[model samples]
Target: MKQSDIFRDNADNCLQLAERAEGKPAYKRYSRMADAWTALATEQDWLDGEIPPVKVRVLQMQDT
Candidate 1:
């Protein structure tokens, strides 16, 4: 299994754990862990050329 696969599994596990958690703190922690894992997966995908580089656009706010 690849590193990205591991990260994806871990993220899924974290989400499940979060759902089972009762307290806000525990749930939040698990959710954050899941997010971190997902980020790692995204990085791996980028490195593998599976995903294109994200383009950032700055939108100007106009006052009406």
Candidate 2:
């Protein structure tokens, strides 16, 4: 399996944990962990060249 897939699996696990969490703090922590894992998976995909990188736009200032 690819590293991104593994990361996504981890994110899924975190979401499951969040669902079962008893307290608000625990739930929030787990949710944050899931988000981080998902971000990692997306970054891994970029590193592996699975998708194109995001394009950035620069704004030019006009002289008054």
Candidate 3:
């Protein structure tokens, strides 16, 4: 599936979860996640191109 589609799906799932949440905290968490996903999808649609890949570094713990 496309990235945009995935984001939209995630948002829908979040909203559904929010609706079924038992408390304010859980509901808010899901709602926020849905908002985040929706925003990402909107931004992706505006970009209309492939999103750039992010670079990451793996941090290794020092042996004590």
| Candidate that scores best on lDDT | 2
Quick one: ranking by TM-score, best first?
Answer: 2, 1, 3
Rank list by lDDT: 2, 1, 3
Alpha-carbon runs more than 4 Å astray in model 3: 49-64
- Tens-digit lDDT string for candidate 3 (1-64): 7788899999999999999999999999999999999999978876865655457999999999
lDDT of 3 at 64: 100
In model 2, the Cα lDDT at residue 20 comes to 100
Instruction: Assess every candidate by TM-score.
Output: 0.78, 0.89, 0.71
**Model 2 poorest 10 in a row by lDDT:** 51-60
Best by TM-score: 2
The true-versus-predicted C-alpha distance at residue 17 of model 1, in Å, is 0.7
lDDT string, candidate 2, 1-64, tens digits: 9999999999999999999999999999999999999999999999999989999999999999
Choose 2 or 3, whichever is better by lDDT. 2
The digit string of per-residue lDDT tens for model 1 on 1-64 reads 8888999999999999999999999999999999999999999989988889999999999999
Error of 2 at 48 (Å): 0.2
lDDT measured at residue 57 in model 1 versus the true structure, 0 to 100: 100
Candidate 3, lDDT over the whole model: 0.91
RMSD of 2: 1.6
Count of clashing residue pairs in every prediction: 0, 0, 0
What RMSD, rounded to one decimal, does every model reach? 4.8, 1.6, 7.9
lDDT, candidates in the order shown: 0.97, 0.99, 0.91
Model 2 ranges with Cα > 4 A deviation: 60-64
